[model samples]
Target: MNSLIRKMSMVITESLMSQRTICTNIRFPTFLQVSSPLLAEPMKKKKKMDPQIIKAREERKRKRIEKSIKKLEKNTKQLKPIEEIDWPISLQKQKLLRERTETISQPQQGQDILKAWRSYKYQQSLQETKMIDRISSSQLQALEQLRAISEDLYIKAIQMDDLLLPFTAAGPSSTPPIIGYDVLDGEYIDETPKWK
Candidate 1:
């Protein structure tokens, strides 16, 4: 009878411990679920950009890319002819030409030789000026185009009272309450808070 009593007590204690463990496991998950949202990371909000500003930026980027591509094409075209120049033979020919030019331009003992040298020097200077003009021709053309665009923009600005031009023909060329002021439109309604 003593052995049976001891066995029964041990079994009761084991069953109580099992029940407590199962209850704690269920409650632990519920507690975590309740607090999870409070402890969770916050979501980041996306920045809103103006459509007009984004469109203008994209247009500028496109123009820049086109300009760069044009420049690259021009550079490639120039490189093709330059690649044909045989370095060794060209260098030798250039040296010989320089020697001949120098010899012709040198002032000798005779006055006739000095006169010829002066004429040669004058001719060389003329050639150099022509070469400089040729080199600057493309730059001058670009400058003229820029000036024309500037003048066109300036004329448009002067013609319009407002900076922005009216895109639609229905509206007045010059916009706002200044050009087409109507009595019905609430232009002068003051919204300042009255003192109590």
Candidate 2:
């Protein structure tokens, strides 16, 4: 009996749906209208250009290029050779030091004008002592030579695009490395990953 009642309800629902579809079509014919077919040729894009506008844009681009070229030429002219350039006082001091080193030599002998007996005695005693207290002529000459050699090395370094002057220091220990830090959980480390 339950199966018979279910079959009757399904048949009634189907009939009602068919009646609704038929009534909607007759009452609103526009809803059932079909769209027209597509054109064979594709539609043109709406990006038409005016000749005057195009000319103005091109003129602006040309002016920008001209300005950039002028800037490049100016920069080149400003970058004269070091010898030709006028150096500031501080720079002149460095150059003078280099030139002085090249020209350094032994000091000339001169007469001593000490009137005080104590001063005279002190000078005599100093002369008698082993040349440790005084800068001997030969030692001065050797130091001058070393300075000249260092200047030459500096010039060479500059020519090779290595402007940093050489220096020496104690080597880093293996136990606690100087380069990298030990990372701990929830703690900041000195190492930056972006540089690596």
Candidate 3:
């Protein structure tokens, strides 16, 4: 009797499964006809990219680059050569010292003046003198000391004058400040008028 019930349950389940409906959350893809004589209709062709569209895109890119280059050229000024630079008063003194090093370094002539001049020149330019003849340790130290001396002297000059903007005072000013300057609080001050 148990064997008969098991057989009946299996048959009933199989029949119930066959009778049950299927439900899908999404619609199925419409399959285009591939080929036909016995099955259905004509074959579908794959989509091809147009060459005219690709050529047009490349042309647009070329025009954009040329436009940018033309705009840059229009906005920029012509560059000047290094020799045309008019150095600061401090640098002019150094340049003269460097140019007249032989005359200045003669025996019994003041060697200290040339050293002081070099220091002044170094501070005026705010860079190293690239002379490399392998001098002794003492000479190297002296050169460094001269540089430091000039820098300290520059600071002292500023203190004596009651000055502002140390870098502008030293280096060859790329953009010289006009008579008036804007303060931190948006007020303009005439720097020409000495604050006594």
**Who wins the TM-score comparison?**
1
Q: What is the Cα-based TM-score of model 2?
A: 0.21
Which lDDT value does model 1 have at 97? 62
lDDT of each: 0.72, 0.68, 0.67
RMSD for each model, in Å, please? Answer: 34.8, 28.2, 32.7
Off by over 4 Å in 2: 1-44, 79-196
For model 2, state the Cα shift of residue 137 in Å. Answer: 39
Question: Which pairs of residues have clashing backbones in candidate 1?
Answer: none
| lDDT, candidate 2, 1-196, per-residue tens | 9999999989976866555533456454323334556778877888989999999999999999999999988898576558657667787778856675355333421223334666889988887775754557766676677667897755544464433676677996678555776566786677857753
Q: How many residue pairs collide in each prediction?
A: 0, 0, 0
Ranking by TM-score: 1, 2, 3
Comparing 1 with 2 on lDDT, the higher-scoring candidate is 1
Q: Can you tell me which runs of candidate 1 are displaced by over 4 Å?
A: 1-39, 80-196
Query: Lowest-lDDT window of 10 residues in candidate 3?
Result: 28-37
Question: Higher TM-score: candidate 2 or 3?
Answer: 2
